[model samples]
Target: NAGVTQTPKFRILKIGQSMTLQCAQDMNHNYMYWYRQDPGMGLKLIYYSVGAGITDKGEVPNGYNVSRSTTEDFPLRLELAAPSQTSVYFCASSSGLSNEQFFGPGTRLTVL
Candidate 1:
């Protein structure tokens, strides 16, 4: 089974383009999160979901959104992409609140 998966490993977008970074896992995790990593910086949480129909914004939620409609899928939506939003996005999942998170490979996004 795929632990976690992300689509379009690499993408380049115009300044105003919009896209959705898809994330899915077959582990049936209860906690899911979206994070972005800038060069030489630690990961920053953008959004998260504890279960289906429950979503919350994290430290940096501007220009991004997320929805959790199922236990195995959580997608991050970037509306009106910008150069500041260019970063490597990661999707992670954990079975419980205190468990270690399993992260997806990552989606590299470039906005020019």
Candidate 2:
């Protein structure tokens, strides 16, 4: 049912380039989050928003930006991407009524 979807499953960006990773959910979740996973490490939260027009930085929000304009869409933007930004980005959403979260396939971005 495509509970959640992320575009450009894989991408390679040159240093200093910029791109946005798109994510959407059809479950009408109220909480959305963006996270990055580096090699051999656990997922690190990048940003999160409780609802539309509300957002807050997470543990690793240094080079990323995010916006929740609607309950369905939450996109992550990387400006002037650097080598350190190369990793897999994931988008997740939760109904806020429980402790469970639904995740997308993830976007693997490589900043070369």
Worst 10 residues of 2 by lDDT: 94-103
All candidates: TM-score: 0.98, 0.96
Global fold similarity of model 2 (TM-score): 0.96
Native-referenced Cα lDDT, model 1: 0.95
Residue 94 CA displacement from its true place in model 1, Å: 0.2
lDDT of 1 at 24: 98
Question: 18-90 in candidate 2: lDDT tens per residue?
Answer: 9999999999888999989999999999999899999999999998888888989999999999999999999
Show where candidate 1 strays beyond 4 Å: none
Q: Deviation in angstroms for 9 in model 2?
A: 0.2
Q: Judged by TM-score, which candidate is best?
A: 1
Report lDDT (CA) for all predictions.
0.95, 0.93
Prediction-by-prediction clash tally: 0, 0
Our tally of clashes for model 1 stands at 0
